[model samples]
Target: MAHELIYMDNSATSPVDEEVLKEMLPYFNEKFGNASTLYRLGVDAKKALDKARQQVADLINADVDEITFTSGGTESDNMAIKGVALSEIQKATDKNPRNHIITTTIEHPAVLETCKFLEKFGFEVTYLPVDEDGLISLDDLENAIKESTILITIMHSNNEIGTIQPTKEIGEIARKHNVLFHSDAVQSAGKIPVDVKDQNIDILSLSGHKINGPKGIGAIYIKKGVRFEVFMHGGGQEKGLRSGTENMPGIVGLGKAAELARENLETRMQHNKEIRDALIEKVTSQIKDAYVNGSLEKRLPNNVHFRFSGIEGESLILRLDNEGIDGATGSACSTHDLKGSHVLAAIGVKPALSHGSLRLSIGPENSIDDVDYIVASIKKVVDYLRELSPLWDNETDEYIGDRFEKPLEDEDIDRY
Candidate 1:
């Protein structure tokens, strides 16, 4: 087994940076105060909040007042989607009852579930289809818009496959139709360039944990004058968008992380991309039947997704973990679902192939020196797994047994 643990599951969460931690330490003890109050402690906390808000806003090229703190990406997504849905419902008249929302089939569960929840309340949601490369058609977007279409909510990049969408074009289409455009930028904010004004985005969501900051803290960018109802009630914190006492330490850490991310964006992008490409090239060239899942050219700098025939993703992850290399089968949030990834399904990957998918999301801590070990370990594990797999045909190098047809029997569990 490898001695050092190599973390390649950054899309799940990244470790807090030392600088971020340093910035957060004082907030927990010395600077602890209610941001809503007027005392000295409160004033200090309020100043930190304002500074943090500006830090987050600067990362995405938005005005400071446009940023609102939230619990995390889920709350931010909910705020953008359901908040708009509820607000539109309130403004509905006899003739102009705008109740439609447009989103992609490959969006994160936060957006997907929120859209489903609104569907329960008589709201219409159009889940757009993506191409095999995980890109939506701009024409399809424009054609789907109707008089009742109120909002277009799409993710900047897929969390699982890391396929970037044409967000700028999508935003233009939304604006041309006079519909609000919102993007779940939780995965793309720190890893890529996300200019709300340049991208024509009306609302955006980002999380802290994904960007080397503290967890349970996030921020959303809502363009000035964009209408959305208050999702969280009480205290009127976050300018009445979200409520409850502010998590000062978390906010501070996030602000620091955002500042670092903005300052190091170019370096981060270049380093991650180099490492990502090396891993992809090494793995694909060395391993047979290893297919990349998304568009390599349009992919995120840190993302590398591959599917190997005749091997289960869970087994691959476990074997990789034993080799001191951590990876993921898909989104960490949906790993418990026990179903094939919706993103893979949307991109036309076969169900059996989807079961073999592995996502190795790189981070700043990972270096190119780690690539050979990762590829070698993966090749060895794949060989061992395939040798034992009844599904695999060694001579033909193909998957013979169908997973759907042959469910795990009692004997199979006993063998393990």
Candidate 2:
């Protein structure tokens, strides 16, 4: 019999919830209409769009008017960063040209790449480094802020290592400095409590697929008083902030998902945490040189990151795939990059050790039995890979094979 697939990559994306799907089906055909029109069909769509906007706002405890739907997290992030930067640039003066952004080294590529793009236009960015547990120093963030700093765009929780930042504290600092704070909550929104008012956040971004909603849908929250230029301009959709024909089906799905997530947030978090903790305990106890990444106390309920010596993360993932387990080495967004994880590097992990990492993000569907099966499969695969690795000596836990006996000469390094 074929083994049943055990999915552990929820951080990458999740299966759309059945309830969310049910809520979306009608919009594809029966209720399909442009939300900007005044006819009955369009009026219904407009109602749905408003409800979804409110649902998304409730997830972060924001006013409904503050929410604006977007294509996805990337677009929302771009809009937040660029919208604010462009607005600041337009209002720049000789004495107060706010072109500086503050972010951490462990942020998702969505935020990092956006910051890099702004650098081309003479924007100065301060990428703060994190510690071994993938957490930033508040002092470092405070020290990085200057008179010219306009925005602090940090991620709420890291997608790779699952380290949750002190967003409230960061927000307080930004508020004190009179700087706008934007958090990429794409990974943390539904799974954790994200209260924009309580956290003192000015702008926030979240995705649909991460919370068991349809892909190609997301929402951005901008506090009422926070002003950024409109990101998109068209026939005046989304209150003229984001202008385009609304994705009716996707928006409905995201709305239903948000509603369900809010209603069952505690139950979902508890279940995921149970399975996540079990997997962590069993895997570390069963496998040698298995170290957990990020801070356990401040991590997401569903994230379990581990670094196993002697085996490449790609090999581990492939081996686990054969056994019906889905896992990841780093961010799904950066899997094709081939370089060692910048996230691991930021947390002080060596490139050699960073190569042997795995990220297993649990979901409500996972159970304790799934954790046991994953632990056994990983131990078996890691043992097999370590035996074949020239860099790993099982007995001594050191590299002592013939391959390591002699140092490569200048000419010997070019063979590969």
**Top lDDT prediction, candidate number:** 1
Off by over 4 Å in 2: 395-416
Per-residue lDDT tens digits of candidate 2, residues 1-416? 54699999999999999989999999999999988889999999999999998898898999999999999999999999999999898878888788999988778888988898899999999888788898889999999999999999999999999999999999999999999999999999999999999999999999999999999999999999877898688988888999889999999999899999999999999999999889888988888889999998999999999998777889999999999999999899989877778888777666667789999998777887777778889998998999999779868866433343343332221111
Locate the minimum summed-lDDT window of 10 residues in model 2: 407-416
What value does the lDDT take at residue 247 in candidate 2?
98
List model 1 lDDT by residue over 1-416, tens digit each: 35599999999999999999999998888888999999999998999999999999999999999999998999999999988888888888878788999998889999988888888888888888888889999989999999999999999999999999988999999999999999999999999999999999999999999999999999999999988898789988888888999999999999999999999999999999999999989999999889999898999999999999888999999999999999999999999877678888777776677889899999989999989999999999999899988879898887885654444333321111
Q: How far in Å is the alpha carbon of 117 misplaced in model 2?
A: 0.8
Local distance difference test values of all predictions, in order: 0.91, 0.89
Candidate 2 residue pairs that clash: none
